[model samples]
Target: MAHPLIDELTDSSFDELISTAEVPVLVDFWAEWCGPCKAIAPILEEIADEHNGQLKIAKVDVDSNQKLALRHQVMSIPTLILFQGGEATKRLVGAKSKRDLLADLAEVISN
Candidate 1:
């Protein structure tokens, strides 16, 4: 089962979503033309479903949302930023495996 993912975000909604989320958030900075971004989409969906109540998976398109992408210093596509308490705690650039993502996410959530 795959959980629903927040596939787009704006500056207006970013604060409310990240700052006010009850659990940790994984924000994926992606673009329509990025192969790696497309590759990781399903994996992200799966993780979201698996950690339904514990975390959130959000996707931001760099091409459409340039401001938001710049704010996060996203120089690369498919960058995953882990947010806790409205602050970015971990940043993973490029595509990563599910096992690595799980381990990294677990480390943050546990702290």
Candidate 2:
């Protein structure tokens, strides 16, 4: 299981968690078979801890949650989508460095 800061979103809780979140929610779409997803897990964990109040981290298993993935149009693993006010604002595909991730999320924290 992931840390409390990181929420594992399932079909049942996805809409509620993301829609009701006060801060920007970063949803990582991944699968257990994805190496890149596993590689970036720690970075997301760190980000969750570092930006506790400013942001939130969530994960969706594309395998088990196919409908969610299809609706989001996630064609790749480790796709990170930033949700705010129940809408997706940014999409980052593939693995990225912590610095890059932070740079991408600067707007969320700043605004």
Candidate 3:
């Protein structure tokens, strides 16, 4: 299974998506030119699909949408932010294995 990828998010939409989402949301901050971001994309997709109704997975292109990235203080590519109830709960920087990601997500979700 693969999760749907969202490439762009506006202030209003991003707010609504993260704040109002019924399930936990995983926001992947990435750019097209970033090799590391490209590497971890598939793992994210798989997690999104596998978690399906349990979670909402989205992607933001740092290059195209600067506000969200700036607001989040994203200084690097492949930053994964876990949001619950519209608030950022956890952050993972750099490319990570699927197992590690799942563990992190599980820790947050379980709590």
TM per candidate: 0.89, 0.95, 0.88
Per-residue lDDT over 1-111 for candidate 2, one digit per residue giving the tens place of the 0 to 100 score: 768888889888999998899998999999999999999999999989888999999999999999999999999999999999999999999998998889999997753
Q: After superposition, how far is residue 99 of candidate 1 from its true place, in Å?
A: 1.1
In Å, residue 68's CA in model 2 sits off its true spot by: 0.4
Error of 3 at 37 (Å): 0.5
lDDT of 3 at 41: 86
Give candidate 1's TM-score: 0.89
Residue 77 of model 2, lDDT score? 90
Candidate 3 lDDT over 32-106, as tens digits, reads: 899989898888777766667787788888887899899999999899998988899999998988888888888
Candidate with best lDDT? 2
Off by over 4 Å in 1: 1-7, 108-111
Name the weakest run of 10 consecutive residues (lDDT summed) in model 3.
1-10
Q: How high is the CA lDDT of each candidate model?
A: 0.83, 0.93, 0.81
User: In model 3, how large is the Cα lDDT of residue 29?
Assistant: 92
| Model 2: residues with Cα > 4 Å off, grouped in runs | none
